[model samples]
Target: MAGGMRNLDPVIAVDGCAVGGEFQGKARPEGKTWLEGKRWEAGALRFCANLSRCSGGRRLSSATNALAATSRNFRQATRLLGLDSKLEKSLLIPFREIKVECTIPKDDGTLASFVGFRVQHDNSRGPMKGGIRYHPEVDPDEVNALAQLMTWKTAVAAVPYGGAKGGIGCSPAPDMGTNSQTMAWILDEYSKFHGHSPAVVTGKPIDLGGSLGRDAATGRGVMYATEALLAEHGKSISGSTFVIQGFGNVGSWAAQLIHEKVAR
Candidate 1:
């Protein structure tokens, strides 16, 4: 079979003799015997040769499948180890939803209509805790999901709080200078149903009986947590640098506290 392969078709011979179905054509010098019978099949020879020269000549399909399977396996393992199916299922319970529509007089002597919603989900632990974002896209489903997350978050933190979220579907952008007034109006409307319970929703202005330091509470909490983490390794936040992404209330407060207490 020494010269028997000499006259055989190069494609078939290469496929038959090559290990792992890979054929290396460039190792041979130009005009060599192996190149003599090599015929191009619509550039198939070049494609296979280029692939063989690659670090690993494995097909993209096999590599992709392998990566996907690995990721799936890792996710499964994490879920099995980290998640409690029964607890998660129990947490997913029916929630109470409130929807309101009202008209507020704008600065231009025009009345603008606004829609608002509040979702109270899972008060098993204590008072609910979540933010009341003011956005035009606010809806019942989004509020409910946020409330549910707050429930989980407060529980995980072992805080004495349940989960509730509320929002008004109005653009609080600068274009709506009347938005601040609308907020007060919405707060009043919500209080009619919730019975003037400022505890029901946080982040209210000080005039609305919001806690004196409540505005900065979240940021201070983050600073405390970061300090705790650093202290765990016998380190302090004296020279540690942090990059904050958001400039909202929480982010601003965190940055302020870090700069004053930790970074300084």
Candidate 2:
């Protein structure tokens, strides 16, 4: 319809009807407008917009729209810093977006395909650093948002690394059929182009060139952060009572460190 409308003369308003910019139950032509006296377009765009608004049952989660929030925060920071608009825009754009099809053979000798995405948000500071998450819900938008966050976080911490995030649409638990093997596959897959780059990704198993403190880094960070905050108030971890929710890898390590401090 759009192609046919192009190269045609301006569509005359039938019966001088004002263009109805909505669709009730079905789509129908309402009125038309001419673009540059050549292309004639109707109110279909508005109709589709309204239809989408009406059909949407629930609002999208802020997590799903993480990039939008990141942009807003970045814009506000840049505005307060009085940065140049051109530079601000340039910094906001991601350095690269990569999507690949990961096809792996299941135990049953059948091939299963999953979509993988990697977003490298920046490289001004140094090499990009991020994690490769394996979850069925992993998506490009979330990965992009995470990559941007890594860039900002590394810059704030004065770390000589940019930001990147990659993930595959697969489970993380071994019982559910995915685990460390997933990262190994991803590392091997990524190395195909980058050529044996271990630093290209973090959070790998110890056998895969992963650093010694990688697993405990987050918990250690929390410990130091808590210590700093307590020191500001002339208190220490041993003098405080803590309630840690969800004793996962990070939480468990943090609890152990704090307990040891109290024992000493």
Candidate 3:
């Protein structure tokens, strides 16, 4: 809501979230956003980089109050880096925030409508990159925070991409969410506006240009980050006890990767 997200309506499916710089009504064409007022948790960047590992109980902090302790830290980081005011403001703004309404027919011949959002943060380094989240209780603010987090993360990590977050508020899915099929649908839907923009999305089936090792990409990243962080603390991943939250692709791979390291 802080980023003129009110201006984005849930009427059209989405003419926003342009890939490769090709959308007509680009939000704030000047590449400025009003998201500095939004707050992010200290570890929110880490939380967002990985796929949805901690699912169902833990939220990404829906409250904007202090944005959960990273507000001042964010500014302090900028100050520490001796960033100029204009650049600082630019860093704080998101590129675009989009909301759309999507409806599909259920197997029972009933129509199901769901609300979807895509918040695209800065892309100075490269294309905006993020993940899709599906949950009945998906929080738009959380997604916004995630988008903001992605910008900070990719920038800091030099990942050569910006941040963007998308989610659809929908029901449980053994049939709907959490698989390559879902990405296929998303690719098709997004392609309706932008022709053959496969790169607009990731995690699709390999036949559809999906990359190898993507399933383990998030988990592998978590492993590497943990190793780096622990190295600074004079600790190692060996003999560590871990408690996983969600056993999704990310969580499962994280567990496996960490275990492999620990065993080694």
RMSD of each: 21.8, 19.1, 13.3
Candidate 1 Cα deviation (angstroms), residue 80: 5.1
* Clashes within 3 Å, all models in order: 0, 0, 0
lDDT of 2 by residue, 174-207 (tens): 3432234545665787789879866545556779
Q: Which tens-of-lDDT digit does each residue in 1-264 have in candidate 3?
A: 111111111110011211111112223455332122232221221222222232211222435332233345578888898989888877666788889998899999999999988888778888888776677876666577677777887888887888887777876655432556667787898789879878877778899988788778767876776666655545567865455444566656877998898733
Residue 102 accuracy (lDDT) in model 2: 75
TM-score of 3: 0.68
lDDT digits (tens) for residues 1-264 of candidate 1? 000000000111221122212243333344232332453222111112133233323233433342244334435654887867675556565357789999989999999999987777877897665656567766676667666666767877899988877777866655422222334555677689877755443445668754568657756776776666556545566776554544455556777988886564
Instruction: List candidate 1 stretches off by more than 4 Å.
Output: 1-87, 175-200, 203-209, 228-236, 245-248, 262-264
In terms of TM-score, which candidate is strongest? 3
Report the poorest 10 consecutive residues by lDDT, candidate 1: 1-10
Q: What is the TM-score of each candidate against the true structure?
A: 0.54, 0.64, 0.68
CA lDDT of every candidate: 0.53, 0.59, 0.58
Against the hidden true structure, what lDDT does model 2 obtain?
A: 0.59
Residue-level lDDT for 80 in candidate 1: 81
Worst 10 residues of 2 by lDDT: 1-10
